[model samples]
Target: MSDNVYQKLMRVQSKLKAPKNQFNKFGNYSYRSCEDILEGLKPLLKEVGAILVINDEVVNIANRFYIKATASFISIDDGEKIISSELAREEEERVKFDLAQLTGSVSSYARKYALNGLFAIDDTKDSDSTNKHDKDNITSLNNENKWTNPKLTDNQIKRLYAIAHSKGVVAEKVKSQVEKQLNKKVEELTKAEYDKVCEAYENIKVANS
Candidate 1:
């Protein structure tokens, strides 16, 4: 397949420079945050006629909460896209941090790494490192995941029901939503599908007590 879009992405990857501009006081190291990656990507995206989107979701992997960040770079012309995902585990205990603060911190780190994978920004190296960028010698290729996605775990479904119940929603209504949006029973939904419904439920925006 002639992927001109992939070439455009390579162009962005070779040129998009995200320097570690922020200093970490406690760690005594300079690191770039998610905001820094976005600022660097915005102009290059415009230059290549592409758009980048990053989304975060809370997921349980191995009974621990993780922030799953998925980043996509898409060509405006053909909708061809390159996608990358990175997961950051939430701290088991965060001192002086509320639930929201802890989640936000993990989400930022995950998002930054997701963008890094998409744009080939290596944070391990110093801001100024040798290795002439891959502008001239670029090859086009396709990227994807071939594994069959697993269905939602039992705990996830229960959580969904728990959300609806807490929201004053009826069991029948929850069942109806599962069948209507998914066209199948909740038991048949995949993890990604479950996240779709879970995100929808979460979007309801509960008022903080």
Candidate 2:
């Protein structure tokens, strides 16, 4: 009997070890981001003939906002896929960030944990679990713009897609073009890049009018 996709993925997951590549000065601790996990899993995924994909959706429940990130592993030879999801709430009051930034932060956090669940990555000693004082300081620093980026919200992304579709432009083509021009994935695009993409799409809509 041939091993299924889940078994093959488990084999890869057993060898995956994402090291802490970032340090928080305020917290005086090291931590791993979603990017770090993805980086570490790249070679392992290739070795196992699997592809990893991540996507996010925004949810509102009882006037509270949450970001749900879904991570999936797909077998290359067979089309079998395994998926997991995790949700993070928008810490609007705790963190002095705009709605978009809050959503992005929550999305990233959810994505990290979702991937962790899929890969069984143990985060027992991570900064979130330790260093409460440092975490508070880090939150303060984040509000001061010491570490934060402007990002697009789920609504913004949907608006962009709607504009592209209305202009008879393929949504995927526009996304690919923006990613190629900015040299980053749509999800990873910075605030400036996101604004630029939106502006370009707006221009297209205007020109066609």
Highest lDDT against the true fold, candidate: 2
Q: By TM-score, how accurate is candidate 1?
A: 0.56
lDDT of 2 by residue, 12-50 (tens): 888998999987664466788889999999999888888
Q: Which stretches of model 2 miss by more than 4 angstroms?
A: 130-209
For candidate 1, write residues 33-84 as lDDT tens digits: 6787888989988898899888988776557656688998899888988899
Error of 1 at 183 (Å): 55
Per-residue lDDT value at 64 in model 1 = 64
Taking all chains together, the TM-score of candidate 2 against the true structure is 0.60
Q: In angstroms, how far off is 15's CA in candidate 1?
A: 0.9
